[model samples]
Target: MLKERLYYIDSYCKTFTTRVVKESLDNMGNWNVVLENTAFYPTGGGQPHDMGLLNGIQVTNVEEIDGEIYHTVAERLDPTGEVEGVIDWGRRFDHMQQHAGQHILTAAFVELFGFPTVSFHLGKELCSIDIDVEDVSAEQLEAAESLANEIVLRNLPIETKWVTETELDQYSLRKNVAVTDEIRLVIIPEYDYNGCGGTHPSSTGQVSAIKILSTEKQKRKVRVYFACGGRVLQQLQRKNYFLAEASQQLSAPEDSVNTAITKLLETNRTLEKALDEAREALLSFEAKDLLLNKERGIVKAVFKGRTVKELQKLARLLVAEADDVIVLLVAETEDRLQFVAARGAAVEMSMKQVSASALLAINGKGGGNDAFVQGGGERTMAGEELMNKMLVSFNLDI
Candidate 1:
């Protein structure tokens, strides 16, 4: 016979003595031990497996295969004697809290609205449930969350019962039970009754609290992220830490941070607009200076520590402002070279030909028409050298 899962008998049981029924090395060279009976819950029902030790050997994983629970151990142990199994209570209880909180929250959504949970996942740090709804509103989420907390405050009894498939119709199930022969129902009397095999605390108060962190649209469903029990406190601590840092950096109290941020953003926008006007004025002056230095309808210049975007903008301004002119500009960054070539509407030379010829100097790639072309590549050659190469293609002196 397979080992009786003691978790079903007592969800709070942390330690038990069970005989090692069989032991074998898995393909990964880890020992997989079967026991006569066990308290360690296997990985199922969207909850992770219990982890701790078996006979002082670390139990890293637990899985159910063919009705037999196999405990994956870190080291090989004696295949024949009685072994002491001890579960990590903190991990197990946290899972129980989260799983139970999921039940309460899911029930609340179904009760307040017609939304049903299409799927659920109990993660290590957080839990999420996908609702069979296109979207969820803040008001709906708050209402469901409030009701869940209310149930927790009431400390309602969380009852569990085993019944055959024929006996399931007596209670109103939240959804259809997955198993027919041996159905385990987790019930909060007059509140929720659902088929579940996962372990839970004896009462709703153990869940402590449920805080919905965020919601996102997934396909035709709404996936809600939430934290429960100790996770709620953990989330609060993390957010408070961030809030404190923000308050200090903004030089404002928590209450005034929002207003301060809004004002700061408005001021930043004004400063940006002024800076844009200044940049345009500077570019206009630079274009005039370059036109004076223009040689045979071609203007070439190289800049250090500038972005390709700035170089392109300057080249565009130069060609647009002057008729019968061509502009070749290069900006040297820390690790690469960027260049722009452009011709005015009156100029007949192809910017693409100039760019393609100059790109060979730096092993670069670019594409454009006769009006404008841009590219960037390795800093093998100085920006000035690259610009000179483009000038050579146009048969103009640099």
Candidate 2:
């Protein structure tokens, strides 16, 4: 016979005495305790299991399998005697508020718009519902949130009743029941009627309030993030802390934080653009100087702690100004080496061949067309030494 689930009979019961019928080890080697009557709710219907103490031993987890609710514990209790079962009321009530709030908010969405909730997840910090819609707007979310809070304010009674599959036709269910044998319907008078096995509070007011945190498009549906009951206050405090820190860092008042940040970002962008232009001008002058000092028709240069991008820009500038020049540059960081090889329009050298041969010195990898090639690898030698080695491989006089 199936043990009576005391949680279904009284969701508000925090403490109860139940007889331990069986004790065994699960597949994972965890101790499982089965009770004749249990107040603990198992993990089901997207809601987590209730954690509590059984005969003073901590119950870590609870799961239902084949009509049996197994309470995972660390130690075994006397199977022949009754044990005191005390659930963590705070955690249980928090989950109840979130679960009930979901019902009201979901009902509000269906009543206001035509969105149907597809899935739900009650997370540690926040809860979310996936709606069967392509998109959800801010105004729509606000309207639903307002309506849900109105229901909570009205203190509408949240009732649960057991029904069979045949009796389901008497109620307008928001979703199909998962079980046909013993279906439990959670109803909110004329507002909501849905098949649910999860425990809920006695009234909607116990949910306190509902706040829509954010929403995003997920596949063909929309996932809406929200917080109910105590979670709403927690989210508010976290956001307020962030805003306060940002305002302090920006040296702006709370009311003007947004304006101050916008102006600061604009100023930063302007400065970045000006700095980029200055850097480009400096690179052009350096390219000209290197060209003036070129040995024959080739310009070879080595730099310390320079980037591959800078080397590419310098090489491009040099080749653009002189058509008969070949540019080979190497940059050396702490333990890495980078090089770029390019030929001017009038020069007809195979840069790919030169790059392949040079890469052998440092076991590097890179690719490009004949006119321009860039690569990087481990620094086996100094930047000047690597550059000389590349010139020798290219068979060019430096």
Candidate 3:
């Protein structure tokens, strides 16, 4: 039988009494560590270790290296003093809520959909559980979530048992794992039964609520991120506050606020779509005019005070439709200028030639091709002048 003392003592552990198992000197010979029989939770499973005191020496970190627990302290204690272990129960229980909530949520996946909770991670900022599944339909996930909350409401008790290798076989367990002679099984009543060594709540009802925040594909499985208990309460409060603020700003009632916002968004989308089509038509007309009105049978475009790719697309479209076959367009953002060139024999304009006259004339920089070349010039009020200068390099006047 394992002789190690259980810090969780059949309930929530706040303080503990333990003998100093051993003392060791570090490689640097500067810090000393005291291993003890019991300890607060350590920085494992991505959750931070408890920080309080071991015999008033100010414990910095506690780690379970091997099968023993070592408490790292800031200052050395008198070797003879009794090691009294105190934990930050508030933080410990906060993590308990999260871990326990994970069980409730994951079990719901199994109880409702027969999906197994493949792996789990309790991160510092959040916790996630992975389940093997090809497609997680939103409706199915929602139903699973509803069942999870019902378990929370029912508040089924949470229990842990130390079972032996032979006893493990008696349960018809889910697959199998490489565990020690004594395995700790976290039982979720009729919902789940899995081996875990992490701290958790006394009952599922203590979780109060749960939310499957999001799910992401993890190889052959799906990782679900969730929050529960006190954290869920905090999340709801923050969400309600934002909704109330939105309702006030939009001058809508709380119950109808959702419908009102949806309608408003649809209306805005329609208007924006119509406006975009109109703008494209106008751009097309101007592009056609540019090709026809060219003095040297070359069409060029230069837009100033904006950095957008739309002008490039317009230029390509124009070149495709026109016959003489040269399309050049450039735009300048606050930080830099860029240009795109297309069409017949555009590569003749070298960078130096384009920079010296074409782009240099407009004071912006960029050039490329026998069919297309780009260069950058300094910012100036006249961008069309740069295009004109570039055409000059090709021995064409416009």
Best by lDDT: 2
Whole-model alpha-carbon lDDT for candidate 1:
0.90
Pick by lDDT: 1 or 3, better one: 1
Q: Rate the local accuracy (lDDT) of all candidates.
A: 0.90, 0.91, 0.70
Q: Which ranking of candidates, highest lDDT first?
A: 2, 1, 3
Report the lDDT tens digits of candidate 1 across residue range 263-310: 999999999999999998998899889989988788878889878878
Cα distance off (Å), candidate 1, residue 87? 1.3
Models 1 onward score TM values of 0.87, 0.86, 0.73
Q: Please, what are the lDDT tens digits per residue for candidate 3 over residues 84-151?
A: 87877767777888888877777778777888887777765567888889768898889988988998
lDDT of 2 by residue, 309-335 (tens): 999999999999998999999998899
Candidate 1 vs 2: which has more lDDT: 2
In model 3, where is the ten-residue run with the lowest total lDDT?
344-353
Candidate 3 local lDDT, residue 130: 88
RMSD list, candidates in order: 3.0, 3.2, 5.6
Q: Give every collision pair in model 1.
A: none
lDDT, model 3, position 74: 78
